[model samples]
Target: MALNPPSPTPSMFRKKKSSSSLGPMSTAASYLSAVRAADARARARGDTPLTTPALSLSSSVTTSSEDTILDEGEESYSDILTYPSIPPTSEQVYTTVHSEFGHCSNEEYRAVSQHPAGKPVAPHVEQDPPYYVLFTTYISYIILILFGHLRDFSRKYFNPGEFKHLVPHDGYAPITSDFDSFYTRRLKGRMDDCFSYPVTGVAGRTIVLLERESKDSNRTFAPTGRKVRTLNISSYNYLGFAQARGGCADAVEECIKRYGVSACGTRVEGGSLDLHSQAEGLVANFVGQEDALLCSMGFATNSTIIPALVGKGCLVISDELNHASIRFGVRVSGANVRMFKHNDMKDLEDLLKEVISQGQPKTHRPWKKILLIVEGLFSMEGTMTNLPSILELKKKYKFYLFVDEAHSIGALGPHGRGVSDYFGVNPRSIDILMGTFTKSFGAAGGYISGSRVIVDRLRVRSHSHTYAEAMTPPVLTQVIASMASIMGVTPALPTSTSTGTITKSRMPEPEVPEAYPGRALSSSLPTWMDLPPAMREGTEGRDRLRRLVFNSRYLFRGLKKLGFIVYGHDDSPIIPLLIFNPGKMSMFHRLMRQYSTPIVVVVVAYPATPLVTSRVRFCVSASHTKEDIDTVLRASDYVGDVLDLKHSDGERWPLERIMNSAVELVQMEQPSHD
Candidate 1:
């Protein structure tokens, strides 16, 4: 999550003084006192406020006409504040944090008025040559002083509409060479297309299949030397469904032919349709579960389900690397959350043991009601979860499990049924299974599948479906038809196995657990993750994810062959090419600006990622051909070689340099320590 907004500062206060001799100090002093008292009372009630007001003076004026006669040769208060003999000139401008709430009177206000201590001050003592000049001259000088002070005050405070006009025009100097260089590098990199590959209308090599158009939808032009177009990388479409699949198009056309585009209201109202129920059944059928409840988006599925299932007494054991959506949902659930290390079975076991030992005394249940949550596939690492091991652990410590298959459905297991199918574990074994239709199916919606009771409970209880409108009919029809085609649920039957299971004779099998409830009866496991049909002893989701890994490896290899040291997993698609010594990220961006590439660089600063890790993230996609990968690698190679950076696999070398610096500093501090 991004950092919180900064707190307001207290330097804006003005010390209040007595406006009248008979009265106490300015009203601001009383206000502060009241605020302090309120704070004291709040603290007594155990509440702490983040902001408090400071004292300020009120406005008052007292003067006498008789005081207008000034003594000759006496200096004015204005003369003390401003030297009229010297011409006014611009002072240095420095950036400063400012206050919005405080206001003070200018020198002009003080000049003709009584002091805060109530001593009378002289009024305008002008012996004017013209009657009009007498009042006009004094008024004009006072107005100028007041305006000047007001400008100063405004500059020092943060006003909502007032923002600094921070422009990097040609003649402006930069605060630091390092910062300047960073922006420069980013601009330069962007100009040269170092972040992305060549395309027709896109600068990036990979064509991001987007379901909806974004701000840059019309900017589909790339003109590198070889020519290119814009390519969007952050698209959620995975299965190429958005490109108008024959069967999917038929389904949508059929839906439109019958139901138009939408069902039009909340599902509980008039929006419920046969298509909605059909899609739910298709999802449950694909996963080989009893029932499923569908919601508007996959984000809402988990976001709604988590908070609904777990409550105050429930302890939610979540993987530390779970998605932001899951973390958010958990927060709203009001359940006690314990974070386990990412993919660490030992950590999960320890947590389970601790919960069992600690929680049993307070509740009637023996901690078996505890919920364990994990992702089927880690999005960042592109690594598959160890579900077989997790299930084994689950067996040993009997906790309810919730698996998010956002990245797994239509991408893993036998016929892409997700993690359980990939592991040959029956879908029913998982307590709650959630998935989104954004990826693979190339549509939008999410579903939670489990027992009929759970499905019914969620249908009535899940906040997302209960409150949000049902999915549009056309999108639902397309998604349902797509999943059905993939799972062979309709007329495409029996070429596939029953109960979403298939047998294989590829290898020697491990001992199956006796009557592992809901375990699929399969003679063979899928090979999409492992090597093709060779019976390799690798992993379950191994075969399915190999294409991404292979693409990443080839890109890394090709880029390295061109001499650029990149960061990130070799087996993962998102690669970060290290630009450790860029002049500035802005410069890099400028360089890549004209280049027909679209890779984005991750900016590293003192507060962001460390300077040592400054680099651009290059994401490879399955949509990228070998030629496309080669072109991107060569461009990076050109930029790196031009910049003359000595690329290492990823080591800074001279390990002793940093260590020796520490030692020398320690030696210098020895006398002081002694």
Candidate 2:
């Protein structure tokens, strides 16, 4: 039951413009030809790598990508990792390693990430599980609570000394009520083994996880002096830039050798490095903004900059599911905060109307400003903010918009711009564009981009800029190198735009599609930094985006076809496969890790998600191969069958069918409801 590619209609999405050769539509061959070739490959295969390889191997076995490398002496031929199921034709040459970045050369495996022309974007649909699954999930929590209270009740009477911290100890009042830490002591303590497991090495396609064991009910952990390389879908290395060996890494090393580590003082003080200005300029260009300001830490970008943007008399309308950092910033801003249901435009509009009409609470005085704050892509739920609808509302309400693209920047849209680019909205329309480097750029820090006036105001008023250390040289270099890779080197043409922030360059740029996001100008990068040819030409960046989308959609659809409840749009790299039952969440994690390939996963429960919808979030990476996705699907299928987790509404496909039909499956466009 593959979805049909919905036809284009008139609305928000504009007609397909001439595609930019920079990324999305640029393939080895024409898309029509690639599709035909892929369809033939799928149909003509007789004995070509039957289904998925064995996945439930010993935990002692190495990761999937390394299976070929480790067993080189034992077998000379390729394994599941090297070339996946289909062997590469003699003509193909792969320069990247199968482990660091999976070897995917399929021209048919890519799709334009923009919304369909003239079609309105669809909001996310939250799938429900069976009533019994809900009952068991609730029951498990109830049982755990009962046992916790009973144990606490017994401990109080028998071992009163254990309650010293809860009681008034010595002189100071009790540190905290026993009730305050009840959940931590009881629930989180039991499952503490799953959280914060230590790891070493690059968190690329495969992460080297340190083996540790805690005997005393998760009280403490001691590493077993063992490192296990597992298929990594846990880290936020969205575009697979987190490499210890790359041109970007080399640039970072060069920067460190020259500038050393620390930024020393705040940007407002003496700590300002020339790299900061360069990175800020490139970032502004990348996002199509007039100017940009950088912050040393990702969390601080919002917490510090938001306070500078709005204060006392302003109103901040936030999506209820906004990240905690945003909440922290809003509170510090001293603005009147109101929340609407997540991604519900009608709800947001209704709330806005009520607030704008009511004005300031007591005096009914006109408000200084109203800011609509939303995350470009929510991390936990994986739902994208309805940017198109919100933009339409922005025209009428006249509220300044602040989009937190922490997870979306460089991970969404065809040009890797963000949600605005994904929805075909001009980036300038949004008042402020905020994002972090930790996710996509494989660097440390965040940035806020906007008009020159606003950025200049923030440089003086923002706490992170004035108090926090300026962005370090190495991080800035990594950002520059990686971002430059995606942008390619823009050509020289003394042509300047009205913004006057444009820089002249000597290097030639690719023929960017008219609709493509603005590329980072060559002059924006430090002249000292050197990059590999693929990156300089923007081919690697394009491949990463293509692989990421393909992997994301493959995993998402594969999970759905396997009858598992999933949240988020398919194009989004963050895929949350619902596991619902509390106990099942832990079991699912352990089973996936202990499987043949040793897939390390992140299982999220309660506070992060609604209590009943506890899930395992698979952050698909450009590093993962199509075979890697199939491996995940196979593992999930096994675990789901064991735990009775496959209750999602859908047409179920056996794991083998899904594996063989990956290319056809990826090209299947989602049907439009309208």
Deviating ranges (above 4 Å) for candidate 2:
1-58, 61-96, 261-268, 491-516, 672-674
User: Per-residue lDDT tens digits of candidate 1, residues 1-674?
Assistant: 21221222222122222231112222222332333354445546543322222211111111211101101122321121111233212220000000111111111111010011222212211111233433443464355446654654575385623322333346765444633543333323233323333322121222311112224322233432321222233333433344332335545665676665344443647457766776676566667777889888778788888988988778899988788889889999988889997777777888888888788455646543688999886664344566777888888988899999997776554346776765567677799988888776667888899999999998778888778888887778667655644543211113423465665334443333223212222222111111111112212122223333344555544554444554432333445555544343434443333233433233332223333334555554433333334335434544554544335543232322322232232122111000
Top TM-score: which candidate number?
2
The CA lDDT of each predicted structure is 0.49, 0.77
Error of 1 at 500 (Å): 42
> Which 10 residues in a row give candidate 2 its minimum summed lDDT?
8-17
RMSD of every prediction: 32.9, 10.4
Number of backbone clashes in candidate 1: 75
lDDT of 2 by residue, 286-404 (tens): 88888899988999999999899899999999999999999999999999999999899889999989999999999889889999999998998888888889999999999999999
